[model samples]
Each structure stands twice: as structure tokens, then as C-alpha cells.
Target: MRFALSEDQRMLQDSLAKALVDVSPLDRVRRFAADPADTAADVWQALAEFGLPGIVVPEAYGGLGLSMLEAALASEALGAAVAPVAFLGSVLAPLALVRAGSEAQRAEWLPKLASGEVLAAAAIGEPIAGARDGAGLVAKAGKLTGRALFVPGGLAAGLIVAADAKGGLHLVRGDAPGLTRAVMPTIDDTRRLAELTFADTPAEPLTSNDALAALRDAGWVILAADTLGASQAMLDKAVAYAKERRQFGRVIGSFQAVKHLCAEMAAELEPARALVWYAAYAFDHAPEEASLVAAHAKAHLSEIGRFIARTSTEVHGGMGITDLLGLHFWFKRIGQNRQLLGGPEKVREIAARVQGLIGA
Candidate 1:
């Protein structure tokens, strides 16, 4: 069967792209990175004005009530612009709650999250490349004590959904009595990551234990989609550079070697897009296939994204490394995206489990 985006989905994607053009240009991204605080308040406000924070939230909670597929489309646009926002952290925390929280919990958190009044971040992957399951924190007597590292947007988040050693999900406020966060510097300045330490921090348990796998798969799918967008942007930049930069009295685009590089990059990235799109669609429609497809998409796109980032930089020669061209933003973003959630090796192992190729 042929898969295609519906008209409304296409329109939503286009609208978000148009909005980012003015709000999160490369110069704006550079400015945010240069600031010590690493915030994009104006750019975030622009996205909040567009109701993106509520895109995947239920309608009862003041959201558009869209599906994961639509959210993936928005993610693509965010990746294309390399916009500095907490979209992943904000969306994933609420999603975990929505999937497993009690009715009271949903009533309290979903509306605020939908309205962008509060931002949520997930502290699932503790050791960067560890298992996506919440196996890092140990819970006792309604309090948690452990360290959760590499939490994206944790320092800026108002609420945090943390995973426990037993696969249980817990919600802890950012200002809780025994919680501390420190920003961790990463290669990608556009995204913020933090290491959180909990010293008997109080937390509320989410009731839905079955939702953990779903949430993990969703996170992988969104990251893959983001990488897909970044890959395309890098390819576009490289092509533009090849067309304009001249060597030996002719445009570099005239050279067969440059043409081959661009062509090979396109060939690798184009198929990866289908994998990401299909993975997102599967999450909404086919539950049995979602995990496997999400893993495949994340693994494949991450590798291709690295290749695109490297090849694109080479296309510009020394100019690519200069801050003036701003190619490093995409390059660094791809580098970080590769290891988030889990690297290709870890994800491929997960996929093998789904296929019964290895013992669980």
C-alpha cells in the first residue's frame, strides 16, 4: 500500500515551516547558543503561540488532539531549523502521564501542559547509552534516590517524569525538596542537557505501567524524524555551496566528484525518511510493529545523518568549519541525536529482540 500524508497533515507541516522561517533562522540559533543561559524565549514564544506544545495533547486538555504522525511532521520542521526548544522533553513527559497516569494526574498535568503553562522533561536514559527503560532510579517510601544523567531540557523544565529501577514512572516537580540539576555542556549548544541528583525526592507514581514501551518507541520515532529533517537541511546547504563556489574558472558543481557526493548523500537520506515516516505512522496505527519499526528508523537515520553531516561539511571545504556558514549547528545536532535514547548498536539489539533473533 502507498503511504501519504493527508492534506491537513501537509498543511500543518507547511504552516510550522513558514512560522520557523521568521522565528528561528540560523542567526537566531547562533545567538541563543552564544548566550550563557542557552534559551530562546522569543522563538519558544512564537512556537507556543502556534499551539505546537499542545499538538499531541487530547482535546479535553486544550490541545489540537492530533496524532503522533502530525507531531513527527512538526519535529521535522524543528530539526530543519535547528530551533532551540524543549519540544522533545515537553512532549514526552506528558505523553508518559497520558499513557499511564491516574485520571486525577491527567486532569492536573495535561491541561497545563497543553496550554504551555508548564514544561515537562523525561529522565529515562541515565547513562546516555543505557537501556531506554527506567532502570536507573531506586524508589522507596514514596521518595526516589539516585542520579539521572543527560536529561534533555531538565534544567529548564517545570516537571520531570523519571523512571525507576523497576520500570515504574514517577513525576517530580523541578523545585522539589531534594532535587538538584546542573547543566551539562554538550557538542550541540542548541540543545540543553542536565544531570539530576535526587536525595529522597518525593514523587507521584503513574498508574500505567504498560505505557513505558510505547513512550520509549514514540521518543525514538520523534528523534529519528528530527534527524531526517536535519539531514535534508545539510544536503540542501551542501548543494547550494557546490553551485556557488567556483574552482578552476568554473563552478564546483561542474566537477563529477562533487556531483557524486551530493548524489550519494541524497540516495542514503531519501530512503531513511520513509523509514521515519512509517515508524511514526505505525505508532499511531499498528501497535505490534511500532517498536521494531521505531528501532529501525532510529538506527538507520542516525547513521545516515552522520554521513550527511560529514559529507556536507566536506562540500564546503574550509568554509564549512567557519561559524559564518553556521553548518556546525546541523553537524553538532546530528552528532548529539545519534546517541540520544540509544545509539544504533543498542537500538539494533532491541530490534533483534522484536524479531526473536536473540534471547530476551
Candidate 2:
């Protein structure tokens, strides 16, 4: 049993990196800032063809049935390229349903999603759920009436929903007669989010504590991987600028201050990278502790990523702030990722609680 990426994984990463670079270039990300339809459709279509859309779906369901670690690695690559596809929303959410859905439901829906015939989304962070003193939502019976905000790729979802009702997960159609979706403005234009309202909409229920938690835990791990990738991009950008930018009589990169800062950023990044891999490793081996470890990974990477993005911009001077130099891409994503998965403080607090550092 080796604990390293196999030859196949490396090949997968290399192939995807080569193909997606052209579609998800940094310059194109800038242009898509205000365009709702500015998603990387060609890239997504290609990925579906590669069987990634069903990476975790079972063979009976038309998926590769790969491990969560594979999904995490793929997610990291997507983030590194700033690819504009919603693997989390499109695949992870449905995988959640597949894990917990009844046999009948799984037989009906999983194949559709695995083949990319129907896109889905998970709506966990509804307004009230994430707001101060927020209480989780419950979907009772067939009708759902509530507001789910900041739902990523919701507008593009064919089936969208994830509300806990009496200790069970609920699913809903995106265009259920009573559903209303409106795209919400976000700093990261590459990823689309929305405000979804379910006005007496229909829903299906899936009951399985083990499966539900497994799927959600997998999502947390993937997000951590995303943060690590984004942070690495920022680090790379800063290093390049330090090497090329001039100051005084020579390249500013030679200055002790710049070197020290870059070194510090590297130091910060290393721990987060370790945490992410460790968490993903835990996801496969230690299902019971995966949630806490995933939270830990997400917490560490998010803070470090934000720090790197900010400093990357600063090192580039005023030019970095301008769209021309494009440091804002990293900065905006850092801010977005900070809020994603509940941020550092939220996750740290949760982790501490899990460890009994504070009274539960």
C-alpha cells in the first residue's frame, strides 16, 4: 500500500492541466467577471467525457466509483487552473444523495448525474443557517418553502437541494413549480452562486446518517484542497514578481525584506498543504475523524491562502491591485474561500468543540 499518487493519477493531472489551461486562462476569468453564461462549458463537457463527473458514483450508477481522495486531487487541479466548473455542486451534492438515497432513488437519479444528463447542487448554507444564531432547515413532506442563499451553481443545477428534515436529507428539482432562483453577486466571478427560494416546492428524502455524513465530509475535504491550490497560485505569482520586479539599482527580489516575506509565505503554505493531504488521507482511512480533520484542513488553508493572496498583491505594488496585473483574481478568491466552509474562526471553534477544548 503506497501513500503516494500512482502513475495513473499523475497522468490524469498532467492531461487535465494541459487541456484546461487554454479554456480557464487567467485573462478569460477577468472577462467572465460580469457574464452569467461565462462558464467553461467546453472544459466541463470534456471532463464529463473523461468520466470525472461520475468519479465517485458506483458502477451500477455509471460512475468510476473512485475514492474521495481522487476527487480531492482533481478538485485541486481545477482550482489551480481557475477552472469554471462546479464539481462540488454538480457532483458532490448528488454523490451525497447517492450515498444516502434509497435504492430506488439512487437507481433513478445517480446515472443521470454520472452521465452529466442532469446537474445538481447542494444548498446547505441557506441565509438563516449561516446567519448569526442560525438554525438548520428541515424539509417536511413533499412541499418545501424556504430560502437557500449563496448556493453555488444553483442556476445551472437541474436538481438542487439538501435540507435536513427530521434527521434526513431532502432533494428537490431545480425548476420545481415553486422554485425561484436568482444569481447573487460574488467577488469570485468564475464561480456562480445564487439565492434560491422554494415556494411549496416538491422534495424527496434520503435517510442514512452514515452516508450523509460521509458525503458532507467529502465536500469539506475537497474545499480544503481548493484553497490549497488557490494559495499555491498566489505563492507562485509572488515568487515570479519578486524575481522580475526591479527596485533601487536591481531586482527587488534580491532585497532581504522581499526574500523574508516570500520565505514566510512558503512556511505558512507548507503546513496548510500538509493539513490538506493529511485530511484527505484521513478521509479515506478514518471516517469517524474525517469531519474534524477536514475542518482543520479547511481552517488552516483558508487563513494562509488569504494571507498569501494579500501579500502577493502587496509585493506587486499598485499594479497588482489593477486588473491589468491581475492580482485581484487571487485576492477575490481568497476572500470567497475564507467564507467557504465556514472560515477559520468558525472551523477552529468547531474543531475545539470537537476536541472538548470548550464545553459542547
Candidate 3:
């Protein structure tokens, strides 16, 4: 009858949060964001040392063999700190390999991926399925050609798990012939996006037909969890500021309006945390409901995340816009999460179709 994180899950979240705070403080994040050449290597290594890179990998391949719930927890931790690590790719690559890859491919890549000896990026956004504005990938004869946009962590990835037209997943080496990566400018530099162009680039395809669907579901859950964490961080900052900021000989926390804003944020965000946890739990334990719940989680959190970000910024007033507080990082992170994979409208449409309320 109880729905809550297990004691072990709580401990995992606490330990990882502490590690992130130590390795990726606001100052370090600012410096990393300012330098295009900076890859946040220290933070990435710290995460790897914490075994996040291998969280979901099967024990046979040296991973912790954890489930999607644990992965969601790790994502929450990352979003709370706005750490600039390539987590999406690291998590998804192993998943793709495990679900769709051949025995040879799994043996060759899983261990390296689990150990963080190689970094991977993901280009599995829905836009990759339908060529738009001259984007999207096409696979033929074990090679891929065309373009994929908004590839996260693509710039530094050694491997890329790309979804091609027709919903097939392929693994493309970062240095594959005729492949080029270009960074896309965005408000949130904490997690960089890239445009990948492949011209007759060699690729290895995952054999399973369901791999892409699994990836999509997992992606939705992870993005939702990330937004939850970022929103919580923003709310925490707003509350902390309200208690200390004084005006008219009284702390801002004494103001009814301020208390209402913080209370509203809490009311909206706390329920969303449950939604994310349920989505993640369903992904691992209730496979039949995973897609629907995942879509709901992602869409709902995107809307709630925006509310928290804006209201939190409003709480800080002028200081929110300034770089000194570094609040914009969390704000921008929420904005980006809102659009990643699928926005609210798109995800809701998918959910509707899943329930037979709309045509696919």
C-alpha cells in the first residue's frame, strides 16, 4: 500500500547528491559553461567513480544491473546540480546494446561503456524519425546518411546511438568516416547539443524491433525526473532567498504573497515527484503501462517545471536575472528539458493515441 523509495534508493540518492555538490558547485559549473573547450572531465570522472555510468548495465558486463528507477534517481541528482555530464548517452547506449545488439556487439562495447572508458551520445529524438528541414537519418547497407539535430553530448561522444527513419536504432562511431559534429547554440550550456551529419557513415544496427520503443520510454522517464530535480532546486533556492531577503524592516518570508508563491510551488512540485517515481517504477516492473505513464510524466513535469522556474525567478526578482546567484542554470535546464524528446503537446498527443483517444 505504500509508494515510496526504498531505504537503499534513498541512500543512493543521498550519496550521489553529496558527491555532485562536492564536484560541481555553482562556481565550477559557471567556469565550465564559460569555456567551450571545458568538458567537465572532473565531474564526469566523479560520476563514473560513483558508478553512475554503469548503473543500469547488467552485472555480467560489470554494471550495477540496476533498474530504471535507479537511473531516474541518478538523473534527478544530475539535474539538481545541473552538472554538465553526458548521462543520457551513457545510459541509453548500454540499454540499446543490451536490447537490440548482437552478442558480439554487447561483448565488445558493454564493458567499455560500463567502465566509462568510452563516452557515448544519443541522437534518438523523434525528429530523427521524420526528415524535417533536411534533418533525420537514413540507414542502408550498414551505413547511415543524412543529419540528426539536437544530439546531446555529441561533441565529446566516442559512440553515438542514433535512431534512424523507420524507428531502427544504430550505433555510429564518433569518428566514423564522413561524420561531422557541430555544436548548437543554446541558453543552457550545461548540457550541450550538437547537429550530427552523416554521409555514408558506417553504423551497426541493433537487431531487436522493440529497442527504439524502449529507448523512447526510458528517455521520457529520465527527462521527467531531471525536470523534477531542477524544479525542486529552484524552489529550494526561492525559499532560502525569501527567508533571508528583507524589505520594509521585515524578511520577505513574512509577506503573505511570498509564502503563497512558495506554497504553490511546493503544491505543484511535490505531486510531480510521485508521478516521476511511478513512471520509473512502471518502466521496470509494469512494462505494459510504461509508455503511457512515461508520456504522462514527461508532459506533466514539463509544464510544472516551467511554472516553478518562472515563479522561482520571480521570487529572486532582479537577482534572479543576474549571474551571481547562478539561478539561470536551473531555469535554463528546465526550459531545455521541456523540449527534449517531446514537448507537452507532443507527449500528450502520444498519450492520447496510446489510450485510443486519438489517431496515431
Among all candidates shown, the one with the greatest lDDT: 3
In model 3, state the lDDT of residue 235.
97
Evaluate all candidate structures by whole-model CA lDDT and list the values in order: 0.87, 0.74, 0.90
Q: What does candidate 2's lDDT look like per residue over 1-360, in tens digits?
A: 686778987787677677667666876666676566666667678778877788778887788877777777777777777777777875566566666777888887788889987778877653212542333454666677667777777887987756653345677876678888888788887788777777777888667666555655566778778777777888888899889988887898999988888888999998777678778778878877887998887777777888888887777888888878777766776677668647678778767877789985
lDDT string, candidate 1, 98-150, tens digits: 78888888888888888777888988875334743343688898999988877
Best of the candidates, TM-score = 3
Off by over 4 Å in 1: 131-135
Candidate 1 vs. true structure, TM-score = 0.96
- Please give the distance, in angstroms, between residue 309's alpha carbon in candidate 2 and its true position after superposition: 0.6
Two-way lDDT contest, 2 vs 3, winner: 3
lDDT of 3 by residue, 57-98 (tens): 999999999999999999998899999886888788999998
Give the lowest summed-lDDT range of ten residues in model 3. Answer: 126-135
Per-structure clash totals for the candidates = 0, 0, 0
